[model samples]
Target: MTTITTSAPAIGPLSTSTIAPANPRAPSRKSGIAAASLIRLSGLFAVAAGLVYAGIQPIHPADVLASVTTQSWAVIISLKLAMCLAFLVGIAGIYARQAGRAGWLGLAGFVVFGLSWFLQSGFVFTELFILPPLASIAPQFVDGFLGIVNGHPTELTTGPMAAAYSVVGLLYLVGGILMGVSTVRAGVLPRAPSVLLALAALVTPAAAMLPHALQRFAAVPVGVAFVWLGIALLLELGRSRA
Candidate 1:
């Protein structure tokens, strides 16, 4: 009688049917923080790049064709590679910080300046792949390429090279202006660096007009601005963490 009166025990759902809750917000927050860190790193790289760029001197074009082992060529190539990396990363970082307020101008500037760096990489390609063989076999061809500096005609610079130069120049000139304006509007970064950026861009064309030997040195203002911006970004990061 006692057994018959015992009630049946209740049963729960199978463990397989029970699902764990998804934590969507945590992943997103983590990613955002990681991205911000990269942006901060980009700022540092920019500072380094600006310094490298400022110290760069144009390799003697004549010597490139004649000498197989010139230290200047190596240095020039190394500096250029550094600049390319810094510009690409730093600009991307800038865009990230200013994304909210950068608007059309910022986008345009980023695109144009970004392309300039891409094309500038082509110069490295020429130096590494094309120039050595050309120098060994046809030294005159190298001379012709350098001739464009004096406003002289040369087949070396006829089509692609000429176009590359024109486009890169235009991009740097226009892009810098746009980015500077947009940065000022964003108010995410300090005004001084942004103003300096604009000034550097404005003076860049004049620098090109200078003697080839001195043109690279014209990057001083640009370098200084980048250094300032990088330090500012690091300080800002520290403040935010606090």
Candidate 2:
């Protein structure tokens, strides 16, 4: 008797498709590193946004002083601090994924960058926020404070405060260069974004030292580049998820 036997279609190799976990963990260390790199890129963009705002409008000494005395300055300074903190955290994440002692250099570079931002921003904030109040109380303090506010007081500019900012600017330039190089060499990030970041690092020192008229144009390119890098990072992250 010929019996008609019904049989299920054979599944080839059991299809890893069916066995795969619903929420599969990232398969490779590279993926985790890439994710962390993307986070750092995003944080850098946040800091860049705050800087862009600071750059776009002219904050004269008087205006800065006024803003500091008011609650508005507090908000702005607070945002700046937040941005720096986010950047440091992102750096930490990136450092965690590194293989060997190289991570220490990366961490050091980021630390320097963070410290530079603190010093530079602190100088400005103090000149604007603290000095104004002090000047208000004592007319004698006005001249010293004004010099700092104008960013051109012969006494203060040539004194410890200016030296501090100068050191900060130098550290920023140097640390940025080092970090950019390290990032590129690490191979975790895309080449183009890394190149742009390195270029941004180079531009910062020039902008800080050069006359306003000459340096003003640099901001446009730097800002645009940072925004582009951020968008690219976001796209890459989305692609990895997909």
Best candidate (score: lDDT): 1
Per-candidate TM equals: 0.82, 0.59
RMSD of 1: 4.6
Q: 1-242 in candidate 2: lDDT tens per residue? A: 99877565557878555676655565676687676566656646544653553454343223333444556555655555555555444444444434244476667766776676667666655654565576556544445544553455555336776566568768767776666666677766555655665677788765756755454455454344445445545565567666
What is the TM-score (0 to 1) of candidate 1?
0.82
Where does model 2 exceed 4 Å of error? 1-81, 90-105, 124-128, 138-151, 156-158, 213-235
Q: List the residue pairs that clash in candidate 2.
A: none
Instruction: Quantify all predictions' global Cα lDDT against the true fold.
Output: 0.72, 0.56
